[model samples]
Structures are given as C-alpha cells and as structure tokens.
Target: MLIDEAYKSRILRGEKTTTIRFGEYEAKPGSEVYLVITPSDTAVAKVRITNVERKKVKELTNQDAKKDGFKDVKELVKALNKIYGELHGEDEVTVIEFEVVEKFESGIPLKWLKGLNYRNPEEIAKLYIENNLKDSPDVDLIIRKVYSEGLKEAVRRYGPKRVRDALLKAYHKLYADGKI
Candidate 1:
C-alpha cells in the first residue's frame, strides 16, 4: 500500500487506521501488506487489512473521516477532490481498514534487498566478509568457518570484535534497507 508521506506519522502513531481510495481497490481482509511511503517508496511498516467496504461518496460520514485521520466529512471531501478531481456524491470509492502489525525503526526501499540470498545473521556476516574483508589473507579461512560453523559459532571461535562489529553494522544496514 502506497501512502502519502504526510500521513506517515499518523499511521505510525496508530491514529490513521482507514484509508479511502478513489476506486474499488483489490484488497482482501486478513491480508498482510507493507505500507510504503510515496515518492521515496520506503517501506515503513506492515499492516493487516481488517475490512474492505465500497460506498458512494455521499455515504461518507464524520466517523469515516475520523477513522481516516480527517477532521470531518467536509475536510475529507475536499482532500478527495484534490486527489481525485471533482467527485460527485454518487461516485464510488473503496474504504480500506487496516491495523499495524509491525513498524520498522528505519525504513528501506524494498527493491534494494530483492536479490539478497537470505535474511539472517549469517547473511550479514557473509556480506561483511565478501564486501570488506575479501582481500585479507585469512578471508578464505573465515569464509570456511562462517559456512561450516554458522555465525554464532564462528563468532565464538574467532572472537574477532572487528568481525562482530562488521556483522552488526551489516545487519542494521540490511534491516534499514528492508532486507531483514
């Protein structure tokens, strides 16, 4: 779901649970969806759709507007007009209600991690090794240890704080980039 950046704070704060769209959007109840902010296309949070309703513009009430984080029906109508042009009372619209499932501390563009092999501590260690430590003499041995023993075991065996710090940094980078 692509939401306007202006409503990011509201969504994060749990104040905006409903969104009114200009058409009959194909969203199913109980489906989980990522809420990506527009322009930047950053995935900020995950949400579960609770309901989907179709109604005419005239049917929108103050309660609906409130759920959408609007002051009143009039305010919602004006905003809708700005987004969808001149809408008549009988025009149809889709109302989507969702609940926040998880919020990302730092948002990441979804595209960056699409090609990643895995999302875990091991993957972070691998990325750190391959990208930053590839030229070191012990690189081959470290790679072998990482694959054979896994991240936790390798960290315990080596006790390399640099490697640990790198792994932590890589994990946060991937997480912020929406990989993990």
Candidate 2:
C-alpha cells in the first residue's frame, strides 16, 4: 500500500518527531512570566499568546541569549532595561503595556510604591484554591530570593514601615487571624 510505504519511508528517514509548544505556565499573583526568545523570533512567539486578559511581559533575550536564571528585580530590571534600550532603536515595537497584572498573597514582598494595577485578593484566592501554580519548590525558592533582593531597594525607597504594612496588608487580606 502507498500509505504503508510512506509510513515506512518516513520511519526510515528518521522523521519521527513530537510537537512541543510551550506548555501551560502558571504565574503567581506577585509574579509574572516573560517570554525571552530571539529578537528575530519574537513575533512568531508572540503569535502563541493565548491568554489575552492575563498580561504578559515581553523580555527580549540578549544578543547572546543564555539560560542564566535572573536573581531579582534589581538584576532583572537592569538587564531587561538594557535589552529594551538596545531594541528601541533597532526594532519597531508597536505595543508594550509593562503592567503588573497580579501579585500572590504569599509572594515576594514589596512596598508597591508605584502602585501599578495588580490582581486583587479575590482573584489570587481563587488561584490558590485552584492550585494553578506548578507546586514546585523552586517556585517558592525563586520568589523568596527575588523578594529579599528586590524588597531591599523598595524599603530604601518607601521606608520600612510602608513595606511592613504592605506585606502585613497582604497577609491580613489573605489570612485574617495571622494563622499562616
């Protein structure tokens, strides 16, 4: 049969392959996901944007894009802003909202000085009950590391009281009796 011959030929030609679109990613309330792909390939990657209501941040990888883990806002902001600077002149980016859409209750602590629009308590509580996050230990570890490093600058900016209150507010909003 022609179909059998075609299948045999495909097998013999090493054409067996698996499709791998990026899997579903869960971004915690006090977190976000940045798609870092080749600048040349960003438009293609952007097409795969499935969640329109959920804000997505675009972080163009460096010309020499490596798989290094970003540590904190200080480091990520410094590096990512540099990427923005480089692309500002070279590429014509049409849209960039640069918004904080969500923040987890038990996420990286910050004063939220600028008070960018963020996902509120109810949405986050829903996400928590649903257990949408991957439930990976690395997620908490990364959040803690990023929070400690980022909160230092925020405290210096907004003072310790505001930072403490903001963190306490988040806690109280989630757990009224401080039983976390």
Candidate 3:
C-alpha cells in the first residue's frame, strides 16, 4: 500500500487508522500490507487490515475523514480529487482500516546513493527489485527508478501527483517491453 508523506507520518504516529481508496481493493481483512511511502518505493511499516468497507464517495462521513488525518469529509474529498482526478460524491470507494504492526529504519535507504557509494543505475535498480519489487509481477524496477529519479525536478516543479503519473506511465511501458 502506497501513501503520501502526510498520511505516512500520521500512520507512523498512530493518528490515522483508516484509508479511503477510490476503487476496489482485493486484500482480505486479515492480510498484511507493506506500507510504502510514495514518490519513492520506501517501505516504512507493516500493517494488518482490520476491516474493509465499500461505499460511495458521498457516503464518507466527517468522522471517517478525521480518522484519515483530514479535518473533515470535504477536505478528504478535495484531496482525493486532486490526486485521482475529479470524482463525484456518488463514486464508489473502498475504505480500509488497518493497524501498524512494525516499522523499518530505512526501507530503501538513499544515503549510499547520496554519498556516491553505488556502482551503477542498474545495480541500484536490482537492489530496489530485491527489496520491494520481488513479488510484483508487472513492475520493472529500472524503468520505475528512471521515472522516479528522473522526475525529481518535475516533482519539485509540478508536484507529486503529476510526477506519480509519469512514474506510472514508465512502469506501464515496461509491461509492453516484456521487462516487467
């Protein structure tokens, strides 16, 4: 499960307990989910799903938004539309409730890269694969990294949602090349 910085912090701090996804989520109630902080594939914690509820976007209550670290339902809806495009109040959504079980120091530590200790992009790509993408069937580590790393400037210029779209596009390309 990927989350943005704010929600990630809230989850770590034990403030946020519920997450609202815009559509269907296949995980069972008792399944474990590795929470990865987004714009980067950094696994920060592990959580166990306690419940899953499906409802229309309009059905989200202020209480639900509060559990998600938002001030109210309106705030949650606005943020959702910004990230996932315009959504009507009646749009279907999945509400997931989870509890953190464990945390990690550095899921994908970039300190070595910052210190110029890595061999090459390919090696780093492989390292990423070993750490996070091993079980993912159609995601190319290298291509994903290319977009993620390459979009730093764009992320700074445009922001996370757009950059995330670019990264997803890159990953989709990998599927076509049979490298996923």
Report the lDDT tens digits of candidate 1 across residue range 19-126.
Answer: 999988899999988888998987788899999999999999999999999999999999999989999999999999999987765564454323233233455556
- By TM-score, the best candidate is 1
lDDT of 2 by residue, 89-168 (tens): 23322221122223222332212321312333233334333442322353333323334545445456666565544544
Q: Top model by lDDT, which number?
A: 1
lDDT of 3 by residue, 1-180 (tens): 878866777898988998888888776799887787877766677789999999899899999899888899999999889988999987898989999987754343233223223222233344444444432433353335543554344445555554344344443443455554
lDDT of 3 at 139: 36
Model 2 has an lDDT value of 0.30
Cα lDDT for residue 29, candidate 3:
93
Query: How much lDDT does each candidate structure score?
Result: 0.74, 0.30, 0.65
- Model 2: lDDT of residue 120: 32
